[model samples]
Target: MPKAQETVLEIDLKALKHNFQYLKSKLQPSTKFLAVVKAFGYGSDACKIAKYLETLHVDYFAVAYINEGIALRKAGIKTPILVLHPQAVNFKALIENCLEPSLYNAKILKEFITATSIENQKNYPVHIKFNTGLNRLGFWHNDINFINKTLSLTKTITVKSIFSHLAASEDLNEKPFTTNQIKDFKTIAKNFEKTVGYKPMLHICNTSGILNYPEAHLDMVRSGIGLYGFGNSEIENKNLKPIASLKTIISQIHLIEKGESVGYNRAYKSDGLQKTATLPIGHADGIGRQYGNGKGYVIIKGQKAPIVGNVCMDMIMVNITDIDCKEGDEVILFDANTTAEDLAETANTISYEVITAVSQRIKRTFIE
Candidate 1:
């Protein structure tokens, strides 16, 4: 890739392919792969990422909302898409697009069934979500009987898969909790199959679960962060490549004398002669205000230039006094080398927040 003349998020298809293959290698031949392309493909371009993944023969695609699934359908994605948290209002639209919904609660299940019946649809696929431990969504274990009875009353909708979300599959200390969640999911599946008289696919593993719990990789595994070049641990990160690189160029250079202040509210005061370079990226571009005041730094000519002062809406100034750089020089906010994980650590957050927070306004260029 050439030097970036303006703020841009470069999505690397090669890296995505490598990550997908790497994750797939960990699964059994019988296991299926569901690529989670929600949150704009983790803040990259979802349509582009999904298109590339489709060529890789990803078994399925998962999105958080009906609109997201609709977007993929509009983008010509034909693979099965599971809407993880679809709303009742969009059940009609969801069915029209052939998007599966994860019915987590009685209310939603009832509404979706009504919608499907009204649409004169039969055996329309839908996923049943069980609340193993996430508490975010999904039905309780006791609801299995209710779900089965409800399903018995209608043939318009069929259970395509039964799934759950792991709360802390990434932390070893949470091993007990994660294993329990998996165990609970297995119990739920057994009861569900016995009640429903047939088995739908069972999947509960996310990216971290895929790495940390091989025993739980039941029928399929869902990967979001791992597909985006993060494995949620130092060891796994070495095997994966970050797919997005945020780059910008120096718009201006300034020389500040002692006692000179920079940015809003005079957040940064130079104690000595300092040189700073302004880059056309800031909070509006996902480099949040928390990264200011020497918390975060950008790479310039192989050197680290600390971000000084507060981050403005559309620009940030990095101290470049120790670096040999000039206006129009390429600046790396985060890349494979200076990763988003590394940058996120400076602000006490995770890589997901950093990457997904990247503003959609930023130009997204892909490396095919």
Candidate 2:
């Protein structure tokens, strides 16, 4: 089906492929690669991105919740998918779909064991998340005995891998902390292997960790934002290609005289005769009010137009007085040249928040 000419997000699969290949080059032949497709592929359709990564031969795929894993499974994604934070309530659905859960704590571990036992399943694959200073979700580092006792009681499940989240692997200044986390993971992992009498796959490197700490890559490495063309550093970002381009068009052009207001609550008043271009995107579309009063802009006719007023729910007006533009003229919200990082910096946020906040109502166009 053809796309509407209004507002659209263009996803370049070629750029995605380039990023995957580039990140994969950083790994050893022995290390496995797991791609994250959670948050609907970081707000780009998960199923399509997973299908692409499958062809790239990514060994594993991870999602934050059970429903996301089920969605991918329903989409016919055959790769082994790990559900990062599966709730106990969704254990049945997860097992029914053959999705492996990352059992982080005692409650989840016990519940999953019981669930699998009820299903008459044996040696069902599961991942273990260790709390390596992220403190988000994971078994505590001191819980090795507890975990051993718990798993020994039930032969219904098996540990496929052990992993943790690196809180500051991207920050060069925090290398000391990152090093400690790796050391901690190694100590616990070594003991855990000894206790279990078998070695489970070990991983702790995130995208930043992947770029900075190759020694800690362990048996597998997970790439999330890097595969989406961000390396969390200026130097690393130079080597990656952005895959998503957000483009919109001017819905209307207003000629306002001096002292006239624009958008909601009279947030912006024209200082002189001005041309304002109203775009069909606003706070709801991920461009927030903090980007208002000239903090943010859009590229129109190869020129920058500053955002003028309070960003409305579905509209944002930009000053286009000096640039000749009209209704239906293409406006570049963000692209390779005008990057997500640039917009994120303008909003005092990060690229992940900006891209993920793009409402699902907007149509997405995937291109090679």
Candidate 3:
């Protein structure tokens, strides 16, 4: 749309707003939304996304690291930010930028407590993460005593929120497992409240949880992929607008004779004479080699073209024998019609990997 310009990832801000409102509409007025904008907003640009969501009155913003929260604060984002996995080494920056850390373990908790005291931080808010099912991070249920002791030690600082990650809220068939997680979290919260005076702004649902388990939408929800579109497929709603579209152009075309080989290792040997189009995108540009040798495809003139041969680091060749596409024609890697999820299925991965793995070297064009 902006004329031929190398490979570009187009970001749609209006679609972002639509997705936010769409997800928010499912919640009650008392429920708050935490827009997870870490990893450059899932590789689409965090500062831009955060600024847009700020206008939409999002309750909070979340990042995986202290630097990301610091960047948002530097960009004039006043909304509360939760640093989900902040390290103790960066406690100074977190305090300086007013970024709340998710104290997942006792060691980090003590370090933060000491840092807060040294900074004379009175009532500085922080989040506590519990490992309900996602054992990758957060404190376990058995660690409740340790957490209680930490809180008692850090009376000067405030525990703003307590949260956990859901293992699978999208799978309706796994509803029993999800329910058990919810039940476990509820039990932990009750015990925590008994020790801490009140529940620390409990939250457990991610994007899918927010939609599928409204009963678990305690005080807040941290939505990542849903904000950028694509909910857990087990759910019914597919209304969220996709905020990003990856596009490229046919740089060259070739006519292959019968039995001719394309790309390295003769990976795509032609059955007969065929036409192929080369695109200026490859594994180096975030289109991994996993999509090579007819595994991946691109849409040219609305027709699907299967990628051929080993994908090069900077380019890929797609079969276009049956299509009438020409050199320089625009090609869509994935869009509203084709769907990134479909592409991910072909590549044996998820939409999250496809979107976030898009290399930073590729140019990005933002559209309002």
Candidate 4:
């Protein structure tokens, strides 16, 4: 909430709560919800988001790294945290913080077992990641025997959950592949339960997975983008409300004659008697250069203003020939009306990059 900050990210906690409710209503009575707070809660604010989710009684919290879980623990988040990708080097810290790690390989499993034994821990919770199809990070189907053998040797460690990632859950065209992944995952879970004598909390559905494949929501659903408001599915996005809006101020205005150019490299030439407004946000604030040269736009007082030239490190120009706007006019990068998908299409990227790449330098204002 400091002054003079040109760009700002406004977060709607109320909208977040609404989205949570929507997802909750869609869940079966027995299913649990695990809020994904990794990547700074997709660049909003992890601590704030986690605090809010805790109030709503979110079943669990998820993070991509051990440090992120440690931060949540320090913030007084008592809910169980599942570390989706924790390394062996941070096992001590993870244990000290009561954070769970996803043991995807025998090496990591052995290392965690040793670390816990050194601490004299009992039944320390951890997750097992299976590489059903994503092949990104997890033990393969053949590694199941190796996992069972290792677990049999250790009594201090307990399997908390076994999960996998869905690569193409949003595309209906890939229903066969998605279904196959679910099938493989279920097979692994059955075999794993037989070996371990019980099934750990099984989870596989991401945001899109939850919408497109509800049956895959076995124990818990890890929701990331959907919680921040974009479900990436046509049907789900319709019900989801955006939680973040980028806003900036018009710092100056210029009236150029015909053939006069603007911005670096003179990328854009004024058509004729054109007026341009310069905004106080640019690439440094996650407004990339790809949005320059008439590729992007901003909303000035609810009126569309087309971007003019190359987006600079700290500023971007918008053509406002017909709009009446002062130097201090408010401009919106994207909001409920202007979807992030539109901005992503304009920038030649995706909505995930647009929302997650927002720089931390910009002030974040939360509204309930």
* Model 4 lDDT, full chain set: 0.89
C-alpha lDDT score of every prediction, in listed order:
0.96, 0.91, 0.89, 0.89
Off by over 4 Å in 2: 1-4
lDDT of 3 by residue, 248-294 (tens): 99999999999999998898899999999999999888888889887
| Candidate 1 global TM-score | 0.99
Better of 3 and 4 by TM-score: 3
- Residue pairs clashing in model 1 are none
TM-score of each: 0.99, 0.97, 0.96, 0.95
**lDDT of model 4 at residue 265?**
96
Residue-level lDDT tens digits of model 4 in 1-368:
33223578889899899889988777898899999999888878899999999999999999999999999999999999999889888999999999988888878889999999999998999899999788889998778788888888888899989999999999999999999999999999999888768778899999888888988999888898999889886678889999988888889999999999999999999879999998888899888988998888998877889998899999999999989878887788987779787899886788888888888898888887
lDDT of 1 by residue, 1-368 (tens): 69998999999999999999999999999999999999999999999999999999999999999999999999999999999999999998999999999999999999999999999999999999999888999999999889988999998999999999999999999999999999999999999999889999999999999999999999999999999999999999999999999999999999999999999999999999999999999899899999999999999999999999999999999999999888999999899999999999999999999999999999999998
Clashing pairs in 2: none
lDDT for 34 in candidate 2 is 96
Number of clashes found in candidate 2: 0
Model 1, position 178: C-alpha lDDT score: 97
Q: After superposition, how far is residue 143 of candidate 2 from its true place, in Å?
A: 0.3
> For residues 288-335, could you state the per-residue lDDT of candidate 2 as single tens digits?
789999999999988999999899999899999999877888898888
- Choose 1 or 2, whichever is better by TM-score: 1
Candidate 4 — which pairs collide?
none
Better of 1 and 3 by TM-score: 1
Quick one: RMSD of model 2? 1.6
Output the TM-score of candidate 4: 0.95
